[model samples]
Every structure is written in structure tokens, then in C-alpha cells.
Target chain A: MSTADRRRLLGPIDASPLYSDITPKVHSSVGEAGKSDKEVRKVFIKTGLVSNASGSSYIEASNIIVEVSVFGPRPIRGSFTDRASFSVECKFLPYLKQPQEDLFRGDTHANNNGRQGLTEVEHKISQYVETAFLPCIILEKYPKSTIDVFITVISTGNTTAPSSILNLTNWIVNCSSLALIDSGIEIKDIVTSGHIKYLQSEQRLIVDPLENEEREDALDCLVSFESLKNDEIVGLWIDGNQKLLTEELLSKFIKECSSMSEKIRANFNNYLLKLCEN
Target chain B: MQEVDQISFPPEVLSRIAPDLSLERHLKLGLRPCLRSFSEFKPIAVSSPALEDEPNLVGSSIVSHGQTKVICGISIGVVEAKNQSDTLNQNETNSQDSKSDGEYDAEPVYPVVDIARGRTGAPTEEEMILSQRLYEWVLQSKIIPASALLTNPGVAIANQTSSSQGSSADVTILYPEDSDMPDLFSRVKPYKFVLYVHLKVFGRSGPLFDPCHAALIGALKNTRLPRIYVPDSSIYSIKIPIRSRGNFGHRVKETRIFIDENQDLSNPLQLNKDNIGGASNYGLYDLSPGSTSMDVDPNVIILADLEGDAEEAECMSKLNLIYNPNKKSINNISYSGGGMVLTKDTLKQCFKLAKKRAENTQ
Candidate 1:
């Protein structure tokens, strides 16, 4: 059938309404286990999860789970002779509630309208990871080739809470780093990420705040640091009600978040040693 | 390790390899395979008021340069902002009312863009990115002034006159008080319009943004909004009589308005000239009072449109500039891709060329 005839055969298309649901109530100020605000959640990491992939790693923190697979140093079709091209693809299972649309108000423009396999949030996440990791990779050694990193958020905690998304993103970065290392690719250093939240109500700073403990108005910052590069921050994303934060407070939060990354980096190194022994 | 054996080079490997060698050879000579200079743009042909037989579309255009072709069509609809009470209840439940502040902010009219590449089923990442970039560029560049989409332009004129006493040059030309003008001043309620831009790219050009932008500009230039007559009472209560012309029908209740497909397509809202007196030649709508006119510097050359081959070559770094044809100044400038640092002189030349191109096309 002709395109128009096919369209006519189908009923009137009701493009899904942009505003799908109202923001749910913030359930509580404490987490499920009544975890303290300062206590960082324990992270579980596994390497070589995908035998077929060049390198693969899976990480779980509380209810958040992410898996990363790395492939290549394989020949690239184009004339990328000077350096290797890097590409990242991030996907969230359809069943998960994608709250990313709500965080950035008026994201009506970003909606793909069920057009792309990857949602808008997935695109942004992929782009973010690609940018953050591009500087560290030794691309010149793999000239005319490409490295592909695939990240999958198998499960995420508290989709409604904005902090959970940040937490999930941090886990993805950490997992990808482990996957790249396991792949035996030439690299700079291991990268670890951490998130810190500034609670406005109590005027307190919480490192690695749980989903429930994330205040709607709290200032949240997520920073990724290179473990061996003197804790140099490779990526930083900050968002919240900016009007509530002062210059001093914002910088202070960054400092604390950067320091928190040191701990994550050390733990990641210990995990790497454990994996090698096994 | 087993999956590695199954992996194969993409089918385009041969085509890509040949082009890279030739593209580099030509770049050394400062010429493209098409024999165009580094700064020269490919021949661009834009057909506006296209698809006139299709009554549903308000404006449509076809833009082509070399092998790249893009078709842009615009559809207009009236949408009411969601009720405040529903959000207020949600806010009350949350206790922290700050999150609801977004509701009070002016509702922006988001233009939906659908790009159809070779793939039919789902939108590719490239398409999504292009749509988003187009949306942002349109808004950030203020290409379509918010005031242009008003239900009643007469109110805007009155507000302009009262706000700025003697600086009435812009408003007088936009809404001329003439016999042919519709008596929309009697309506107290104001309405906003949503534009859905449907773009279809025929071939896989290196970058689709430039062509899409030009086609959108051409299509928007060709667009004509209809004069809506809102009835008193709930729109649902009134049964709209089907009409033959342009699809335009609307009904208004206490706070809600409903529109049907009964528009007068014959009488469309004009973009180049005033509909009433047909005297003033103000291209598009007038600039709001107190807005500064953009100044174009005349030194550099602006590549108006890039062809497929040129774009694939050394044109790694691209700057897309949107200009106001009437004011002779740039409305917005966006930079994409990364390579080759542009100098101040080159930047100025780009804007000058953009302004020149806008004038020629309009």
C-alpha cells in the first residue's frame, strides 16, 4: 500500500501527551534500611561477566545495578587514521520508569516520540560518558580503529528520586572503567565517580545520599576522578535549584565530592587486585 | 571471543576509503571534488509554498543542494495550558512548593521535528539530535518571535504603543489599522499556537543541520495562520459545522478553547506584508520595542550552504548563523563539530554572508 493509504488505514495517531504523569510525592527523608546520610552504600563489582566481549564488568550498589561491555581496537571503516574513534551506547530497560524527562523541566523538545531505540536520557548518558572518558583513553595506539562501550542499567533504585539517577550514572562510569581495564586496552588510569548532596533543610552535606534521603531542593553534584592522576576530576555534572547555593557553598561541595572520589578509587583498586588473584 | 569471528566490516568501507584519499588530495589543492573553493557553497534551490494542493499543511518548502535534499512542512494547532488546580493539588501534597514554580513560567511553544532517514520504523540517534538542535536553535536564535504567534496581534500593538510612547515605528507597520483587517480586538482571551515541523531528508548528507535549517526557514516564511473565531461557552457544547476551505474551527468556554478542522485556507496570515492595508513590507513580524538591532560585519565570506562532498571533507567545523532579513542583522549563531579555530575576521564574514543569503532567499 502507498504510505498515505497505509496511514489512512490506521486510526488517527494520538502522539503521546508530553506530560505523562505528575511528580510523585517524595516518600521519606530516610532510606529503606535507615542508612545514615554520611554512610556510603556498599558497592559490589564483578569483572569478565561477558566471556564473548573483549572486556566486561557488572556493578551493583543497593538496588542500582549496571553492566558495561567493551569491544574493539577493531578496524574502523572511515579515515580516522590519526586516532581511534570512541562511541558509547547507554540503554535503560523499557520497564524502568524514566524520570530523566522530569528533571529538566520543559524537556518536551527532547522527547523522541518513540522514534529512536534509545530514549533522550539514554542519549545524554552516552554522550556524557563518551566525553568524560575520551581524554583518558590512549587513542593514538589504536589508529584507524574504534572502541565501543555499551552500558546497560539493569535495575535502578527509586526512579522517582533525582539522586537515584545520579547514583546510577556513577555506577555506570565505575563499571565501564573496570570493563575497559579487563579488556586489556591501553589506558591512563582507573576512573571512579562519587556524588554529594547538600541538604537545604538541615544545611548539612551528605556523601553518597540514598534515594529517599535526596531532598527535592538539595544541591547535588556528581564528579568522576582519575584514580592515579592525583585525583584529577575528569567529569563533573552539577544541578539543582542554583539560586539556593552560594559560590562558597558550591566550591565547598565540589571539594568534598572530589575527596570522596579518593575513597572510591582506592576501593576500586583493591577490587581489581582481588579479581587478579581469583 | 567467539563473537569476534562474527564481526565484519560495514558495507560502506570501500566507498569511505576511496573518498578519504580523494578528499585529502583535493583539500591540499584547496578545492573540493565539485571544484568549489574552500569558502564557496554549493548551489541551493528552495521552492517555497510547495505542496499547495495539500490543505492540511500551513506552510511547506523543498530545499536541495547537490545530492542533499530536505523537505520541511509546518502544521499549526492551538493548545491550552494545563489547569493550575491540578498542579496546585500536587504541590500541596509535596509540601515543598518550589518544584511547582515551573508551572507559572511562560509555556514555551515547542516545535516537534520528525526526520525520516532511510530507516522507517524508529528514529535514529542522529535524527533525535538533529531535532533537538533544531528546536534549541529556533528558540535561542529567536528566529520566530514569541509575539508573532499571538492569537491577536492587535493587543500586542496596543501594548507596544502604551509601553513606548513615541517608539511606535515597528508596531505601526506590523498591525495596520485598515478595512481588510479582522476585528479580533473584541476578543479578551489570548491563545498560543504550536508548530509541528516535519522534515524529511532524501539522502544521507554529511550533516543535515544546515539543510534542515534553511528548509525550515523557507517553510516558515511561506506559512499563513488562519483567523480563528472562538465562540462563547464550552467548545464541546457547540457542534462545529464542517466547512470546505482551509481547516479552521474553534470554540471557547469560560477558560477552555477547542479547535476543529474547518479553517479558511484561502485567507492565510501573510508573513511579508500586512494583511489589512497590504502597504507595509515588514518581512515576518516586527521586533519588540527596546530590542537592539543586530549589526553585521562585512569582512569575511559566509558559506551559505554546504554540499554533501564539501561537508564530508575539511568542513569539519561548521557555524550555523540565523539572520533577521528585515533588520539586516544576525538573530542567532550556533557552532557544531570541532576542528579549525575560526578567527574574528572569518566569524564576521560568516555573519555577513548569512545576512546576504537571507536577503537573496527571502
Candidate 2:
């Protein structure tokens, strides 16, 4: 059967811990899991968008599109005297769940019958970005300040997993940094992000999640890799109850995040070179 | 005046730029030790450090500047010697000759120059050499105050004074009347600290050459990290690859710092104090710095690249850098990928040209 048909028969893909078919989600786990035809997806960089921003770009993967705009290092607005400041705001459509109908409604993309607090999802992003990405920046010079970044998920497709959000943001931030430069803004480090999800029962690891599998997930986590040399994990987003998360899952997630982050980093550099041409 | 075509240096020659370029290119110049022009690097686009509570300045989205450009933002931070910490960070370093705190109880290490240079090519031997030279100058110098870098005493200590500013990060310094100022631990003196010597290289690879020779002149001519503190006095010798007909250590004289007539510095290069900015075609430098003599003559010599009329090459020259007592004449000679060091004459010339250009542009 074709990929779409197989997923359809898998019955909308739910996290294994909650709904234990433990088989379909297992496909994503084995990734190179001995399946002769399994293929890995990639993230691509887009430039020349987000005019209001100093630096901006978009990263698109299967079922996910993240656009990031980089602005200022300009004399920050508040009491930022000697140093710089960064502010991050992430928003999902109010109806983040029920991805299918979630896309049908207004800009808010009503889903979950207009339920599921977006604040939780957005907070994960903010916390992850602040921890993983900030240290990579030279905070000493830009003292007493904030550099603000606002991310809004304009569209929600079926299954925008936590991993997808982290990967997309890393991709977006990297592209946005280039965008920031196109606009003549300064940058301290070149940081990228990635995420991995673990299925508790089957020990299945999903690289980037779509809405369907994520909704079914028992435990989900997000990691942002910030530095190139250190391969440092700058941000971490752990969803579901922490106790439900296992050691095997954490190890698998970190390994996958590191490897994928490197792949995406190469692409980001290539994009920057294209930017330099003009 | 035909807008001279770009000059290119041999790949083997360019490697002298440390961690600035990758290796294979270093093979082109044969990994010879020398310096290149700042503009000569491949394109370099760097962003300022990201601030917490602010958007990330660190992103994979790089602002690409076409061509290989190495960017060095040379920031200067000065604080009194008494307030810094004694230990230095891993990157903090100075020349081998720096005076130790052990030798003299309180001698201030002069402001050392640290360079954080970046470029497209993997780091070359020359880049490493220059980085080391600049590193040693700061790590082992007598100018920086070790006391200022100390944030806590083994254990994290809160500031005795409260943050009347009412901010979460506010830090206040206080000393009681009975406090002994002589205690080296006190953190009050305004120590003059030169944080890091940021260097950037642009353009493709070439032979050993002078980088600061142009940008310093241009910024002076055209318009214009943290860690331990050190002085410039302690450097005994600098390590550099010898590029000569015979491969061996050759003796090249010292170069000194350039001080303009307008400088409010305690002391400066006594030679031609009136001579401001001049000399563009040559790579001149102030090797020695102190109150007694100006622009110290660092006897440690190496090759430098010079670009003019589309021809780029390195030069080795004999000169007194420490406040030249003899301002009589300069010996001009030609050698394989070598020429004269950045003499006072060349500097004065660049300054003149840059000043004139700045005026016309304005």
C-alpha cells in the first residue's frame, strides 16, 4: 500500500502509551528500522519574506512550515543600557488539537472544539529558546536589555508535533538570522534546533512529529541544539508527565537531535551563501 | 587611479591567519607564517550576542557577506587594576615574557590585545601564530588588573549592598569604614580592561601579508570577551614561521605602537609625535607600549602582507619600534613574498590618505 493508505489504515496514529496498537507509530521509530523503503525527510530554507523584520526566513518540512523574523539589536526599547535584550513569543491556533478541522476555521484555526490551552505549547517554545539559544549569545555587552522574537503558527496541519515545532523554530531562527543580516542586524552565534519524540510502550522514536501521531503520543519532548562545535543542546521541551518519560527515550531523542541538527546546519550555511550573492 | 584590480596571495601564504581559514588552502601558501589584510578574508557576517528575554541573535540564518570576509570587532574595555580577579579564562593569554605577579607583588599587566578572528577557510598555521602572539600579549601582560574578573570568592558571594535599582540582576559594591583597602580581594578600583581583540578576514587566500596595515589605516584613514586582564610588557619572544631563502630563525628588528599628537595617553611613541595617520602601502605596528617610551619596538619579527596597485606580498624589515630615537631613514628592499615591516613612514602616509578620503567622502 502507498504511504497515505498505510497511515489511514493505522487508524489516525495515537501515542502508544494511551492507545497500544504500538505498530504504526513503530514505523517512524524504526525509521531506518530495517524497512527497505523508508525515507528520511529534510528541512529547507526560504528567504526574502517577512519585510517588517531585519532578518527573516522560513523552514518547511513534511506537515510543518515555520517562518521566523529577526529584528533589532537596535537600541532596545526598555531600560537596556550597556547590553542587548531578546524577547520570544510563540502562538499556536487556539484550537491546536484536532488538526484537520483546526485548519478550517478562521485565522485562529479553531480545533479541539475551541479548546487546548495554546499557552502551554507557546511556553515550551519560549523556555526552550531562552535556555538553549541565549548562552550562545554574548550577553555581557548587551547588558540590561531584551531582544524580542515573536513566532506565530499561521497554519496548523494534521499533527504538528512538539519535535516539529522545535525543528521548525531552529530552522526558522537560523533562516531569520540570515534575514536579520540582510537587514543589517548584528548576531552573536549561529544556533539551530531539533526535536525527537519517544513512545513509552514500544520504545519508538519519532524524528519530527505531525499532528496525528503527536495527539496520540503518551510522552513528548523537544530539544534545540544551539552550538556547532560543542553540539550543545540549548533548549529542551518535555511534554506529558516527566515521570512517564524513560531513560532509553531520552538517550534516543538526544542522539537523533544531534545528528539531525548537523544536517540542518549544513543547509542553513548554504542558504546564507546564497544570501551573500546579492 | 584605474581602481587597481584585486591582489591575490598564495594559499600557502594565507594560512598564517589562525583558525580563520581551513587547511587545504593553507597548503597553497605552504603554511608559511605571515599576516594578511583584513579585507583579504572571505566574507564574514557575525551577529552580536543574544540577550536573554530577547529574541535569539544566535540563529543558523547567517547574514552572508559575499566573498570570504573575516570580521574582528576590536572592543576596548578598561577598568582599574585592583578590582579584577587573579585567574584568567582558557582563552586569556599574553606573550611568554609577561612579568609574573610572583616577581613583582603589584605590577599591572599592560592592556593586552586578544583577537577572535573568523573566516571561511579552516584555520591556517599563520592564523594560529598571530592568534598565539596576540594571545600571549594579553595573557602574560603587566597592564590588566587580575582583581576585576573575580565575581565570587570560591563560593558565590552576594553583594553587601542591596540593589536599590530594584532590578533582579543589579549588583552593588560596598566597603565598610574598617575595611582594609590593601586587601587584594577588594573589588572597587576601575580597572582598565581590553576584553578581546576581535579580528575578521575577508576575500580568498593569498601569501603572507599585512591585515591591520589597511583596515587600521582605512578605519583611521577612511573614517573610523571577557576573561583575564594582562599587560604588554612581559612578552619575551613571538613564534612565527620563517619565510626566507634559507629556512632558519632570522633576525628582524622590532616595531612600535603608533601614537598620534592628539592622544591623551600617559606616554606615546616619541618619534614624530606630530605625524598622525599616513602610510598605507606598508604594514607598520607599535610592538612595545609604556609610559617611558612610545610605540615599543618588539624585536620579535615576522612577515606581513602589503597590497598596492594590485600586487600583494609579504615583507621583513629592520626597524626600531619603541619610540624611535633615530627617525633618519628607512631601508627599502625586496624579497620572496617579503618586504619591509610597517614603518612609521608607511603609517603616516596611510593616515594622510585616509584623512583626505574621509574629507572628500564627507
Candidate 3:
């Protein structure tokens, strides 16, 4: 074929096909009829799973599973005289599909231009993890060194639903904290994160939201708190159109997330106690 | 008319206008959006070895100032001084026979800084700048004297003797068992160490240089290197084979130094107190016993650590000074942005403030 004809054959892409049309039938209630709204999914945590890493943890809840590994307080080869460096890396398994574009449509500007290697979602999640855990870690304790946290999503719930990203981020934060603790790194307090979606239509806030329940039109906020402290928020990430959100609604959502965080903290403490016994 | 209609302003242009107007309004009112004063700094707390439970680390510290938090960790590793001498020989031969002072003089310690913030594949520009500045400040200030890190007294003497006897003697000394005088190799050889500094800053507080500086200083002060003893010749004789690509297939045999882990850690470097009384030896500052009165007006206000609104103001004058209270001298001074031309009297005030803060923290 002629070069021009071959080039013309590869025409400008007009549209891409949807990955799946069979949206898992939305369940009106995930648990018992009235209990679904108040109930959060049970969290399962396991640590020291990765043999080579200095510390590692795996977290599972509902259809989501995340693994995090902590390495170092090892020497780094640059000219940093004062303190140890801390970094976070996040990756999603290839089997998992990317979140629907519509969910992140309003936040196009938020994608940093300089992050060339990471997908937009991976970059966002890693940044969130770094910011949330930064306050809890005693970085200055190791000078001229680096501590790296690597997080991988083994599996995730259906991504077509809007809440998948939020769920993934929350699990990453929790999993990383366990891994850091496992590595015997000195931390100020355990960090527990929770995701909440505000359903404006029903005027209800859903804590630890499931994928099918996340309404695209609703506002969502993911918050992480230092559990031992007085609910001092270490990291917060909000999504959805701000124009659709009111100050009162945002405050109410925050309060709901804060309360939900307490429950998650209790679960973490129980897990730690069990870990110590062994 | 058609062209003008088609020229829609980019969204970024419209977004930038709003924040600029708000910032300008706040600046005019002499108020920061965070409600902090122009001269006021965020609260700062420095904890040495920030994590009490991690006893394995050599040195660690956490510095939280305002909304910004930074953690610093220090790790040390030994590298053979022989490899350094090879490079020194090349450099000297290339430079027309310049004096080859020992390995330490030929290759100065270069600490690495790795900042993990946000999710970019490569190191961010801010990380690079902060790392460079911290490295420069530490070296220029001579915070830790190079001599203080010499492996051990025995190693230092052996190194001096071998260098004086030429390259053949150096080889014989390193592998004394091969020579007739096996007894000479009985003592352990001293080695040089490279210190690695890692810093992780949380929150996107502007101007990280100051917080990182404070955090690093705290970690260095708390650092205690372990006392390592050289193992016996039997251990050295057990050579590990290393593959090498030669015209004929070959394996290179090398001796390895074993560290005695049972030995106790050496005393902390004590950078703050080492040169306090004998400050004239270093010559960086002329703060001798009777030289407090300044011939030059040192009238700058050096803000040791700046954070929050004061950092964001961008226009306010800020100076970062590293003060050595024990020596009663200013080690290093750096500043950024514009306004408030500093007189010598202002510089003196800055030194006084830095000294006071350093003393209070100690």
C-alpha cells in the first residue's frame, strides 16, 4: 500500500469502546435492608507478607485488596546532609481497568504535567499516601538515608463505579501504615483513613462506600486521621464539582468521615494487638 | 470581530486572576490568609531521633514547623580507601603532579538527599535544589570535621606509613599475609565512610530549605557512629570471586573487611561543642574572646526557620543562618526574595537571634 494510503487507514481516533456494559446490578442495600447505610465493610490486614522487603502488609476489604512494602532507612547516594528522605510509589495491577473518565473530568487540571512515568491515577494516589504518612513518620531520625514505601493494588472492585478510586486510596493509606509499623519504623501514631460520599438527593452521607452505591452526581471526600491524636487530619482529598457543593454540606461530610475514621482506628488497634501476641 | 470572538482566554488565565486579586488584597491589608504576621513564623518543634523505638538507625530527627513536617535519617557505610586512591592517582597525573593528600583530601564526603513527595518518576526540581543547598551548606560550614570521621587511630597511622612507602608498600600493607611480615597486618585497617541523608517533607509548604536545614542539623547532632574493629587475616583470606570481562575469561579475587558488630557505638560527633572555646582554629568567623565588637555593622535579622504565611509572602526578606553557639560564630548565612536592605547592625541582630534560638533548643 502507498505510504499516504497507509497513513490515511490509521485515521484520527474518534471514540473508544466501553470496557464493559454489564454494570453489576446496583444493590439497593449491601447488608441488611436498613443496616446497609450505617455498616462498613469488614477489613482484613496481614503483615510481613513480602520476605525481601524490610516491612510489608496486605489489606483486603470487600472486592479491594492492596499490598504495601517498606524498605530502607538505607543509605542514599546524593548530597543531602541533614535528614533521611521518604518516598511513596503506587501501582495498579494490569488486570484492573482504569476508572471511568467522567469521574475525573472535573479534575483535569489537577494532573501534574511533570509526572511522566506514572498514570494520572497512580500519581494522585501516591501523592495522597506520601502526604498522609509524612506527618506520622519520624523522618529526621535517620540522617543521610531514605525510606521508600511501594504500594500495589492486587485487585480492585468494579472501576466503572465512581467510588473505586476512593476505596483504593483509603486501602493504600491503611496498608502503608501497617507496613511501616511492621518495618519497626518509629511512627507518632497509626493513621486510619475513611472514604465518604454525600448523596445530595437523599441528603445522606455513606461511610466506607461500596462501588455500586457511589452516585456520580454526589460529592466524595477521602480523609486520613492520626488515630491516637484528637482526630487531627493528616491528609484530605476531595472530588466532584465544587460548584455543586455547599459549605454546610462539606462540613457535614467531613464530620461523617471523621466519625467513620474512629471505627477504622479501632479495627487497626485490634489487628496490632493480635500482631503483638504472635 | 471574528478573530476576537475566536480568541477565548485559556482557563488558566481566568483562574490565575482570582487568586492574584485575593492575594493582593491581603497584602495591602498587611494580613496573611492564614492570619499569621509578616515577621511571625510558624511554631517549630525538633525532636532528636524522632522515633524512640527504632534503635537500629544511626541518627534520625523529625522537625515540624507550622503545617510543614520533615523527617531526616542518617546511615553510614564503609568503602575501601584503595578505590579512592586509584582515582586520586589519575586526577594527580592528569593535573601535572599536584600533591596527593590522603584519600579523604582527594575525595570529600558527598551525602545524598532523596525527597519523596508527590508522584513523579524523577526527583522534583524543588528536591534537587533543596538537596544541593543542604549539601553545600554542610560542606561550607564544616559542620562535621572530616578528621572526626577517620576510621580509627591504628588505621590512620597505617595509611600514613603505606602512602609514604609508595604503591608497592601500600599493596603489601593491605595484604600483609602475603608479605614476610604477617604480624604487621595483624591490626585492622581504617576505612572511609559515606554518610547518606534522606529527607521526606510532608505538606507543600513553600521554601523547604529552612525546615530541611533545621531537621538535618538536629539529626547530625544526634548521630553516633559505631566503633568497628577489623577482622583477623583468616577472614580476609577467604576471597569471594568476582566475574570480569577480559580478553581471556577471568575472575578477580578481592579481600573484604569484616566489621565487629559486638563493639559499642563510638561517641556522637559533638559538632556543636567541639570548637566552642578554640573557634579561631577554623577561621570561618573572627569571634575570638575579645573580638565581639564588630568593625562592620552586622545588622540583618536572620530568621533561623521561616514557615506558613511568612514563607508564602515571597516578598518579605528572609535569612537562614546556621549558628554555632559553642563557638559563638555564624557558620553560614543565606537569604532569598527582596526588601529590607540589611545593614551590618541588622546582620548582628540576626546572629544574636539565631544564637539565642540555638541555645534555647540545646
Clashes of 2: 178
Query: Please, what are the lDDT tens digits per residue for candidate 1 over residues A32-149?
Result: 4666776677878888755446788878777776778787777867565988888888876333446654344222222222233577678767877888798889998998988889
DockQ of all models, two decimals each? 0.01, 0.02, 0.02
Model 2 agreement with the true structure over B98-185: per-residue lDDT tens digits: 3343332222211111122211123456555545433332333222333322222111123336554333233222222323543533
Which candidate would rank higher by DockQ, 1 or 2?
A: 2
**Alpha carbon lDDT at A68, candidate 2:** 53
Per residue, candidate 3 scores C-alpha lDDT tens digits across A1-278 of: 11221111111121111111111234342323343666777777888765546788878776676778788778888787577788888865432445654343222211111112556788889999999989888888988988999887645654445455876798788889889999998889999888887777787777777744555567778889996788889988887655678888777777877787788778878888987898
- Per-residue error for A78 in candidate 2, Å, reads 6.3
- The per-model lDDT (C-alpha) reads 0.57, 0.37, 0.57
lDDT of model 1 at position B73: 68
Of the true interface contacts, what fraction does each candidate have? 0.00, 0.00, 0.00
lDDT score of model 1? Answer: 0.57
Lowest-sum lDDT 10-residue window in model 2 chain B: B52-61
Quality of model 3 by C-alpha lDDT: 0.57
Q: Of all true interface contacts, what fraction is found in model 2?
A: 0.00
What TM-score does chain A of model 3 get? 0.81
